[model samples]
Target: MSARSKKINNMAYGKLCLLLLILSGLSLTIHAKLSSNFYSSTCPNALTIVKQEIAKAIKIEARIGASLLRLHFHGCFVNGCDGSLLLDDTSTLLGEKTANANNNSVRGFEVVDNIKANLEKACPGVVSCADILAIAARDAVVYYGGPFWKVKLGRRDSLTANRSAANVFIPQPSFNLSNLTSSFATVCYKLYVVLGLCGHTVGFARCTSFRPHIYNDTNIDSAFAKSLQNTCPRSGNDNVLQPLDYQTRFRFDDKYYQNLLVKKGLLHSDQQLYNGNKADSLAKKYAMKQGDFFKDFAKSMIRMGNIKPLTGNNGQIRTNCRKPN
Candidate 1:
């Protein structure tokens, strides 16, 4: 190729890279706004304190890791990782805790409170609850054997929680692949939805949330459906739990994709990814390549954590995670 042709090709490549960076929620400007070392000087021990607390919680109960991750995901989805979901029901505010998607489902708030208290003792009013959520989420995934990536900090807490936004934003178990993609589209791309759902790789879902899939969905394997039917009947037993990845419920791995490939996915939305659709090939690739899944998952987590965060003077750093100062 001529020199001029090579130069034009390089220019096109640069533009493509820029587009990808913006679409993936990793714009250079956004990275500048939030940094991995945001608290290096103000609170040098912030990350350590969070990691130790998360490790202790996960050690006590392996399921807590998933719970902590879920808390962060839900909070981020509704209010841009602002810790609004951590808020209790104030006299005039309806917290995201009671939203349709999170009510009685999302757990591990006590874990956040513990981390916040420890951080306060070490450096009072130095760390933001929003940043705590982000770091705790990364540590939770790491504790469960998932990939680790630097969690950009400097986020501030939201003064109010939005129950309506939570219900509308957080993807539900009943969602189809298209719905999931649509839900994530405003904040991320299709790949983001696929990788983000890997949160199920380490967590358990309530019976009520997945009952229809087991009892009525034809896509699920017969044995898998029959096995869950006893515990999750046609009626009642709403809170009975079942691991999302039946293969390795507590382990953070690519078994989620493998499950979908075999019609054993525990949720309707999960199976939707593999029904001879665009996501089918992607699922097969991840099922066969655990390393690729981990790498993409870590990137997706960082991208998800970047959604519309309140930085600089836009929001306050709350002393108590459940209430704004």
Candidate 2:
């Protein structure tokens, strides 16, 4: 009931308000760091532009959806999802397209270019190519009957590409279980490695990449291998292509895991997941549950998209995704 008591109570209340303000600011900073609505204000139509471009491309060639998804994975796997894979070779910069894992193997560059061009027109210099790729990947999955997830955005394009790192980091088809596990572990957890392999459920592999498996690998089914060998010769015609999943190549289902169960997985790297290792149980579990595969695939993709993103002035918004500006 005195002036001294009233002053002390007022001081405590002011201190509590200050503390709450600081905590609220920190929470917002973290949330805005990487968010699905990153372009809601800056480029309100960014997601729509990306989805429209992806749908057009998939309509032209359904396989393109898988290629676009693979592009995101390859880019994120090496130096995070910075659109480094989209870069073209230059006098000073040697890009990842020339890497052994990517040379003549990675497809759908034109599709990304199409999306970038449209986005630039809609909201010039607003949406980064890295964010476009991430959103395009989610759209691609939905176009192909796969489960959808909200892609975290605000990633900026990297100023440099790592050609050597791509070769060393990206998993190769010839890789066995040990090599495959180590390759994916470099960028993501062992569990994600399995989910990443599940992406194969929608794509096809070139005959050049799978010939040895169909002809020499003992784990593959005899009839299935013979079927592939009919098109993929032992000696020549390396450019021929075969669906990665014999059952449903275009559908983003768990048939890839089912093929692994039957020793019919098209690639040596794919079968290795079920080759009596820690991943074998996961392979079996996914093989029996399509819903589980869809759920985990969506979760792993969001995690993969979050890897080492360049945001908050860390990198530039590239006008041409292939070159830094």
Candidate 3:
């Protein structure tokens, strides 16, 4: 054909390709908006109700596991909590068996899987498994009767699981304040900032219907309880106990700060959160601000869910959550 005709055909094809690209971009934008809207509208209600369901499941599972004396892992990876941590490597000779052990993390997954099944029935694949983990973590907190705050959703799962990440991320229950601060700092969260953040979730969880059972008292009746009565005399009544002591046991109360005033706090790391005149002032500020705490909790949960997620077939859907390939 003529060179002029060929040039005209090439131009037409180029224009057609550009048009298709534009259309694809627009479609993606619309889909993303719709997904966000769905997340906003459905997440809160589903989270609230599903949290209770998860609480029930975990509690029942915990009770059963306690009778069995099983150990469980707690906390999440940057992306979200993967129940795989609960798998018992001892159960199989070559790590090819199904994970059926009972730990809080495993129970939490069972609870979450139940929630996932329900959400799938309600909204199909719209809700991600990672969001279920976020909601279930809160629910697990509630199941242990710790605290139940509103968890923001739409978290994507991690394609890769990290045992090293687990080692790095999970805070030691008995960690000192400085070490705890370092743990938070690993994720760019400062200790003072974290204490403020904790005040949001911890205070709300305590004040609400949820309760957490705190354990390990090195000097509860002796030194810790005595300090409680000395600080905040109005709130501190008994020499052995105070409103603050109650805070440690109850996850849904502002008493954590109150308790901080008493024994100085449950975790050795927690003391740093309230130490120093500046930290003391921040603690007081957090103690007085309930609404601020709630708002911060919502924001933190949303941020937590977005950490290093796997997308677009980067991760696989395990037929069994406990068994990893």
What are the models' TM-scores?
Answer: 0.90, 0.88, 0.55
Better of 2 and 3 by lDDT: 2
For all candidates in order, the CA lDDT equals: 0.82, 0.80, 0.41
Q: Clashes in candidate 3: how many?
A: 15
Can you give the lDDT of residue 115 in candidate 3? 64
Ranking by TM-score: 1, 2, 3
Clashing pairs for model 1 are none
Per-residue lDDT of model 1, residues 77-157, tens digit only: 776878899999978998889888888888998999999999999999889998998898899888888899999888988
Per-residue lDDT of candidate 3, residues 1-325 (tens digit): 8998976765554444324322331111111111223366554356656656655664554442211111112334322333334333542322211221111222334554566667766666556655555555555544443434555434344334434555565553345444444454434333224322353222111111111112234423345534433542433222222222343443444555555544446444454446553346545755676455444444444444344444445454343334433
Kindly give the stretch of ten consecutive residues in candidate 2 with the minimal lDDT sum. 22-31
Best of the candidates, TM-score: 1
In terms of lDDT, model 3 sits at: 0.41
lDDT of 3 at 271: 47
Worst 10 residues of 3 by lDDT: 204-213
